[model samples]
Target: MSVCKHIRNQGYSQREFLVLRRWAIYPHPSVPHYTNKLFTHHELQHSDYLSQLCIGYRHILFWARWVVTVIWRCIFCAYHKLFGRKYTPLPPIEDLALVQSATTLAEWIRRGKRSAESVVRAYIHRIQTVNATLNALVDERFAAALEEAREVDHRLASLTKQEREALADSHPLLGVPFTCKDNIKLTDMNHTGGIVSRRGIKAEQDAVVVARLRMAGAVPLGVSNVPELAMWCETSCTMYGRTNNPYDVTRTPGGSSGGEAALLSSCGTALSIGTDVGGSIRIPSFCCGTFGHKPTSGWVSLEGAGLFPDALNDSFGIQVVGPMCRCARDLTLALQVMAPHAAKDLASKVQHTDLRDLKFWWCEGLDTPLCSPLDPALRHALTAATHYLSTTFEAPLEKLEWPRDMSIATLMWNNKLRDDYRGQPPMTVDMTNRKGRVSLLAEGLRWLCGRGRFTFPLLMMATFQKLLAVNEDPQDSPHYWKPMQEFLMGTLGKTGVLLLPTLPQLAFLHHEFVPNMLDFGHTCIFNTTEMPVTAVPLGLSKDRLPLGLQVVVSPGQDHISLAVAQALEDKFGGWVSPVPVTV
Candidate 1:
């Protein structure tokens, strides 16, 4: 049989077949040029074989690491308990103008209590003061935002209180200034998205969410930075520099949407737009001490956004554009603006539950199979949260088992991507300014020689992850994690929520993500399982870094999760401002 037919019979897609063909014609870093043809033509299945082997070995490593992480966690946590108590105090929030929530600010602007331009200016000043240190605001429209805010104030002047209230319904966020992750388009702004090649590119249009916010009277201040292609967990890229945590300049802000988290926590913007696939929104929010919400899949529009695999067209529902802010209320407001069509229905469905009837399941710092045990501070935060709810609100908090074994969750998420890709044209993975494929091996050599357009993580993903085939995700089904989703929904029903770890530990130091990669997997599970998760901050840890947990609810029951987040915020004081020591 022909090599093409052999690979086809083995169920490789035309895309995969072309990849193998490319290997035969092009030079490989590891394979000799003379032997390339013989290798691809005769042993095409070897690529798939290598992929499966690596994937299996990764799972084996997961369990092996699981054993060591648990034992080490106990000893390390004890050591920290005795000695790790120093904290660098956060500078006081210098401006009272930055303290109000988006909802409060908008109301004040409408009532002529506070000028909208003043609010915009306050935030812009904050951005300017911090961006030098944080590098969070990559693109700016500060002048344009001020003008828009002026227009809003002018329009509101002629309206009565009732009329202003009516206006608030349609333009709920009117007069509030906001920023979005670079992946979300802001018209006439550089959407570099942290990739080197796209340095001077401009967004010709506003992302759907951005437009909705504008329509609602929220002025756009700028776009924030993201990791290249919004792929990796950290936000630094070749184009824009790294974004530092406001809580501690020494630690990272968490990636993909790390800039958004850093900016929000620093009071650069009370609310901002962000996207998440593999815990991008949740992790950064956890790191920078902010509130973030990943809405139920298909709950928000993805039009004009750069989310991979097209969440709008795909059913996997893992990738989503969401809200990252300093307050839980902003999450609901942002979601409403993003999906205005569903606002009424969602509001009606999201009813207040009696504390007694709400089924609250929690995990108090148990170690997951592949992730390190939760840090003592984070574990204590969870215990405090559950204890507060149980005693104060009489919430029925129960200890529950999370994914001690993530082998199934990872496979389910992988299958989800496969199904999403098959539905759409496969996502492009190039880093050059031009819109075309480039040689992975060629890029690697350039990188080694100190001249590469792509980041190291992107290269690694392109090489082995693309070449090495993992086990086939079941092609017959669109709902890859259907059983798991159903089980979770059935368990939570309508009146239940789960408070779980946002990450295993507090934010790590900058460039220290590689070792804790497994812990980030904790966020990915919810994306695949298809639930609404709200990152609720539980004040700062003893180390003065952010401490938080996720409030997850059944599919379509986002209001329940949002409510739980509010309750927790009320008790714990959500998203403490992480000002610099000199602020």
Candidate 2:
């Protein structure tokens, strides 16, 4: 049978037949015209049959390619895991303090100048030496960290020089040790958030930001402590006790991410991942005298990093995961790795605004009653920072008032908390069971008697939540929040950066924050507005406590706040190491 008759018997559509006929008659453009004339009808029919067979074969090959790709990926991954490069012994790094920034450390590792194992060992040794007195690390994964470092070293050593260079180009954070706030999850780590009830719960997998950091070759040392539920700005919980400031063990290191900041400040770790809703990250960074950037809301993924199961949805617009580092450049590097797409878009637009070309709006304090008067030393630090910027950058500085009413900001923040926890059982519920017994109260009384299972601040925060519940008027919140949001976004939009006090006073003595919790008004304003804020250390106070300022900018302009932080770091000498305390 002719090829056309055979196709018709096989049920080929008239459209298909016409297409084949046209192709056969005209020939493909690539085929020679003379060759087309030489083919008789029988030859054309055979060619058409062959073409159909080729089409069928191509479909089979397409599916086969996918299977082969999948199998190859599996084999490659298994092989890489089994036979990856091994760590080479190196001369002891006598002073780990030399590797100040993750950026520089990663560059050195990529260049084959430093072994990943050495970097990990340096941080582990520092943690061992200081963590006893600082109490910064809630848990230590020394063995696991060392093993991962060895794996990294092995992988690099196995690669050719060119392959090593390619890996370095891909993994900018290669071989750097970093800490994660206890609230930010890492597989097999205790994500306690400092709550006793969660003491045994392990994260099933890494949080999105944690996974990204690992992909970029950053090794996690372990989880750091936080206040119970991370609600208060003091790093004390029934689970891990308290994390003291490296500068003065007598004072707080700031809570939530306090341990992360303390570790970074004390040079126990080079980089850390922290979250901020109402200054959790920045407050601790300020207290510890380190650099921290609270990225624009939703800029960093919150997957697997939640206090409650529904934390992401609950704290939708306010909460964010961000980077904390001893150096400003590491903040940008970590952010880029954590949120590659957003950071890329931000980098494209955020040219470093030369200090001379930048405009500054300075606010000494908030107008709200909640704002505590800035300490004399803190006031002086801000003044000095302003003066340094003005003189060094020759930039203009204008004294700007805290816009959009502080009362409204407070109300909006409270409303957010209310909305965040609405319908969910109160934290007090964690202390009760099916019997309805309030274990927390019993624990609180025991605590009063010096045998408590819960910390004082956690108990106070729970009681305060009840009081707030009684006073909450969610209906009235939007009325105030809408205008405040509009005013803030309009005032600081893109070009402007607001410099404000990170805290009313320097790191206060432990437990002092309980009565003065409202003092967070200065920091909470930006949280409520969802704007990016970077806490930059402005040297130390007269008492030797860390002094700092908050650089605020509009949403998605994280680079602006970070740029200002870098500039300020250059002038003020960022993150002066605390004198190590002997236990």
Candidate 3:
């Protein structure tokens, strides 16, 4: 295949590859374990094992031919870049008049000061005004939202004083407006999930996450866009288009939670839900200035979602449903309602988790299989953040040694991805394709390597670990796999949270990834590790885009991370609203 055809069949170019890499698709400088030597694809040329597994490249050839047919389309983009109209201006932050903190937003509805109808309508208007430029909401339910809001208002009007208070007190999220990943099911919305083939499938029942959100009295505004099957980081799907960052329309909002992040950044919804199998939630939250929580596995239900749901095996431990919002407290609020609980008893009494006595283990490096090099601004921001945390909290942050066996985790995650793929239909692998070759052979090597020590099932399970991959972003290098829990637990004593940069860089132009090699640097490691990570926006980068910090708590220790987030927010106003007078 010609280079262009080869690139086209990849569904993206080397430029696209670099773009995805920078957006956390591959290793970067921050992830210390990601060595350039390992990514040297030439090393794989000698693997006889790979030659044995090569398969037909017909489909790739077809896509390549199609790509060649459409190569001229690039001229349109080039013409536009050179002389076409500039981007549409973002709504001036000043245009925003009514601002609601997560706390105040909920309180307004509870106090009957702002009817759900009005609140939802206001958001609908905001989405209407902004979504054209952002492509944030894949499908909107304005009519249904209004009806639901009206019903909520009417119910409030008819309730007795005690009844109203009881009802209000019951659903903290009552009358609040929210949205979720299109991969997630809602009653009327088509659950496209950015996959064209799945674009027309209407959900018969709400996904467990949606059901929980609605049962808390929240109205679903609509479904947000996501990546194709949420496979890539930047949220561009052939079906719904790309979701832009609120900070810079030219930049990606990050995915597979990009749409939700964009919506949250624009204040289009009070709260939203997103799934994270491999940094899907955290990366978007990092890209768009927002607070997102990836709760511990099984803390929230993933029963009805479609984006890579099969990956969650009976013993699978990497995926989760989490909240995305603009404030730290909002995350806490969302988590309470979202935690696995009956709809009637959604109130979370798990508050007051103090941070004063918390122990923290700060991991400064990217700690992935990629070299996660941070932008200078991101580095400065992170340095400032570390200084503030150590100085203000009077808590000396200790730096932990880098784990050596991190690739073990990446290998495990590769196996998980392979198993997930195999569990699905048509288990065909044309290993002739570079991507397939890497996935299949890497998984096989892991399985074969461990056969001496494990049973068939156990060996397979061991092949795909929930461990942190340190050698490279699992998606980038054939060798990018690692398992590091034994090391982490050994060093950190299995307590306190691990603090790191949410990403190595601030948001960049949409195609910046074209030139960079960094891939899902920090976030994917956690996905592989199956650890709970909370991403909180720290402040804007020098370039004016958002910078976020991540806190990784021991599995099931999400509460501790939230406490730290809350404390950090208090110290450094988390998720600062842009000067809210949008033009």
RMSD vs true structure, all candidates: 11.4, 25.9, 13.6
Which 10 consecutive positions of candidate 3 have the poorest summed lDDT?
426-435
lDDT of 1 by residue, 356-458 (tens): 6688888643243456656788888888888887888776777754322343455566666665555443223446544676788888899999897777876
| lDDT score, candidate 3, position 192 | 61
Model 3: how far residue 496 lies from native, Å: 1.5
TM accuracy, model 1 = 0.81
Best of the candidates, TM-score: 1
lDDT of each candidate versus the true structure: 0.74, 0.74, 0.65
Runs of candidate 1 with Cα error greater than 4 angstroms are 1-92, 307-316, 345-351, 364-369, 402-404, 423-428, 432-434, 467-480, 580-583
lDDT of 3 by residue, 1-583 (tens): 3223433464543444333232232333234454423323343345434323222332354355345424433544464467643556556543232356556766777678888888888889888878888899988789988999898888888877677667644677778889998888888787765543455778788987788778878989998988666655678755676678888776789888899999888878878899887788988898888889888767787777764445444245567789998877777677767774422222242255645455666655544333334456766666776677667766657775552323233344554454334434221121111123224345456647763211222223222332422334344554434334433444444456678777665664564443332445467667766678899788886667888788887776676777777777877777866435644
Regions of candidate 3 where Cα sits further than 4 Å from its true position: 1-85, 93-98, 307-315, 341-351, 367-372, 405-412, 419-422, 425-483, 514-518
Q: What lDDT is reached at residue 115 by model 3?
A: 84
The runs of at least 3 residues in candidate 2 whose Cα sits more than 4 Å from the true structure, single-residue gaps closed, are: 1-94, 97-99, 345-351, 355-357, 368-370, 391-394, 403-409, 420-422, 430-443, 470-475, 580-583
Encode model 2's per-residue lDDT on 1-583: one tens digit a residue.
4445644564545645554443332222222221222234455455766556434454464356445444544564465457643322122225743446888898888777889898899888888777777777877789999999999988888888887778655898999999898888888888777766666878888998999999999999998888877878888877787788878776789978998988888778889888888999889999999999988887788887875656575247778889999888788888889999889745434445565766778888664444455678988889888887778877778886432234445556766666555666676775431124345567778998988767777677677666667544554543234445555676666677788898877786677675567777777777776788999998887778999999988887787788778888887889886763233
**Model 1 clashes, total count:** 6
